[model samples]
Structures are given as C-alpha cells and as structure tokens.
Target: MPSTPAIVVTDLVVDRGKKPVLRSVSTEISAGTVTGLLGPSGSGKTTFIRSIVGTQKVKSGTVQVLGHPAGTKPLRRRVAYVTQDASIYRDLSVKANVAYFAALYGRSRHEAMQAIEGVGMGDHADKLAGNLSGGQKTRTSLACALVIEPEVLVLDEPTVGLDPVIREELWDRFRALAAGGATLLVSSHVMDEADRCDRLLLLRDGVFIADDTPADLRAATGTANLEAAFLHLIRALEGVN
Candidate 1:
C-alpha cells in the first residue's frame, strides 16, 4: 500500500516583481518515493522547488510538509534543502564542512562521517574544499544535507555539472535513500534522468502538464522514450489551449 504524501501544494501561485512565476500549481508528492521535477531551463522548476522548501514567496497557496505548513519552526531540522549554488567553507576540509553542518543540526560527528561516506566522499573527506573538483564539491554539499538524516530532501539540479560516472553514482545513492523511507524531491531539466524517478511531475512555464510514473508516461503517450513522451504531452496541451 502507498503511504501518505510527504508534501502537498494546492492552488499555488508565485509572482516575481511584475511577472507571475507559478500558476495555480497543485500536486502531492508521495512519501518514501523519489519524485523528479522535470522541465526545461525557464520552466519554473527552481521556483516551484523553492516554494516547496518554504523559501520562495507565494502570492497565494498552501504548501504542507509532513502534515504541517511549510516553513514552520518544527520543520527546520526535518527538511534538508540543497540549492545549485555550491556554498561551503573553501578553507575547510570536506570532512570538516560536513561535520560542522551536522553539529548545527544537533547531530554528532559520527553521523557526519556517515553522510560523507554516503555521498562517496569518505576517501576525499580530508581534502580541502578549495582543492576538490567541482563534482567533488557538489558531493560535499550533498553530504552536508544528509547530516540531519532529514525526512525530506529537496535538491535543485544536483547532477547538472557532474560527470556521467558521478551522476550515476549519485542516482544510485538517491535510490538507496528513498528505499530507507526518505522522500526526495530532485529537480532536473535533463530528460534522460526522467525514467529513473519513481514518479514524475512534468512542468513547463510554471504549470504541471503531466504527473505519473515513468511507465505510465510512456504508455499513455505511446512513446518509446521519455523525451518523446514529453513532446507528446506538450503537443497535447497545446491542442487543448
């Protein structure tokens, strides 16, 4: 049986200056499942993700996380969010950065090492962040997010600049985390990664066009691949409007 939704958004609306970013967006993300927010570069994926994480200002809507309103004080330690921007102590070693963040969450240093190892950074843990490669830095950022053992993790374009091998390894780790009952909301514009998600939320221009499992997406569109499936959805939506 399926569990309750980890997050839910209803009639979500977000406006930036004079422009409206999201338009009546609504969706329920299943707990303990990996749900990919798949879209193009300017499709409001980041904005929607920020909304879910309770950082983006909403014009009107409700975002509920774990049965409580988003941004509530109680959820501060329960939700871990990692943005695309790689911000860490350049002078600090990878291990130190992770351990420090864990301490901020009231977690022990041992848990920090486990998180560093989870992101495949145990060997490079002692390496200075300033000297690590871009991919390694990204891994360090992810390890920091894992320190709190959060129930919900929201990552924005985590694999964007990573190499194929590192991307594959991170995806495997994401699956492992989900299997352990952690809900992950990973945003990516890369269509190739769509099929890896347990479920997908297809977004374009701040609106959801389709929400279904990858297999269902393929079968409904009668397409052999995810790219083709997304195209079919776009055309179908175009015809309706």
Candidate 2:
C-alpha cells in the first residue's frame, strides 16, 4: 500500500454560524515540506488550518493526518498548532509554560529549554508571559509547540509584526524543522514570506486560486513577486469569465 500524505483534505466543506466558510476544498500536504497558506483576510486560510488541526467542525469531507482522521486522540500529541493569538498562560513564565506543555507531551525539561532558546526567548525565559511583548508571547507559544517535536506543525501568522531579523530567524527554524522530517503548514498573508516555503497554497474566497511551488506560481502568473502573482491570477481568472 502507498504511504499516506502528511495531511489530506478531501472535498472539505465547513460552515461557521450557519454561514459557509470553506467550499469543497481538497489538497494534500507532503511530509517533510513547508507549505505556505497564503490569502487575504477572511479567505478561509484560518478555517482550512483549523480543519486540519481538528478544531473546526466540517460541514462535509474528510481530513486525514498521518493516516488517521484529524482530531483523533492519537493525533493530539503528534500535531502541534500555534494560533495567531498567543495561547500562553498570562501568569506563567515562558520557561514554565514551555516546560508544562512539554510534560504533557512526555518531553523533558531539557527539550523545553532547547525550544525556548530556539525561538530566541532564553534571555526572557523567566519573564511572565503577560509581561512579554506581543511578538515575544507569540515566540513563546511557538516554543511550546516546538518542544513536543511534533510530526505536523501548524502555524498561523507566525511572523506578524516582528522585526525582519526575527522573521528570518523563525523561517530558518521552520526550514530546519522541515529538514528534520516534520511537515509544516504555515499561514501568512505576507507575500514576501512566500519565498521561504517549498510550496504555496494560495487561497481566495474559500477556494484554492493556486497550489504550486512559489517559483512555478510566479512563472505561470508572469509576476516577479507573490503579491503581484496573486493579483495576476485573479485578474486572469476574471478575464476568462
């Protein structure tokens, strides 16, 4: 039998508050690759991420992760998710939070501290999560996710509002994780960040506009950059109609 994809979504349809958010979406994320989910606000990027993470109830379709259905008990420890909002404990120190979450994954304190240092948060490891800056808290949450050494890592807007240096650093870490045989699904609207991913899943209006490598997307759209490529594809589709 063929091995399963890292993540597979087949004919996924989701509705929130009785209003459809995703419409018949389907895709396969390859293992040990970085797939960037790109789109405008409210383009169903978050919904798609949630669907694969097993946090969103789908209207139809199936989402499978590592050969098992998404949100299954077996996946709880294998999949790591970092939302746009920092889910760190306000009262806990960064190290404390990372260590606590690590324990839940049956990881050691050394692994927790290594993750904290990976995110450049070691200097502030003892600071209260609430006291850290927004970007710092986000990094702390990222550290918590990394401590578990998950098979699949899902990150949403992980580089928002951070310095360019920090963004580069994080992207390096992501590449390293992918190199280590982890599947990474990262969502970011920032066009520049698209270049860092192995593949880009360009979503628009609850559908995939383009699903290809960043280079292929640029070449096919005849654009020099990802943002221009997005507009180019949309306009080409409009012209087709």
The sequence of per-residue lDDT tens digits that candidate 1 reaches over residues 145-174 is: 999999999999999989999999999999
Report the lDDT tens digits of candidate 2 across residue range 75-118. Answer: 99899999999989999999999999999989999999999999
Q: After superposition, how far is residue 63 of candidate 1 from its true place, in Å?
A: 0.2
Q: What is the TM-score of each predicted model, taking all chains together?
A: 0.97, 0.96
Root mean square deviation (Cα) for candidate 1: 1.5
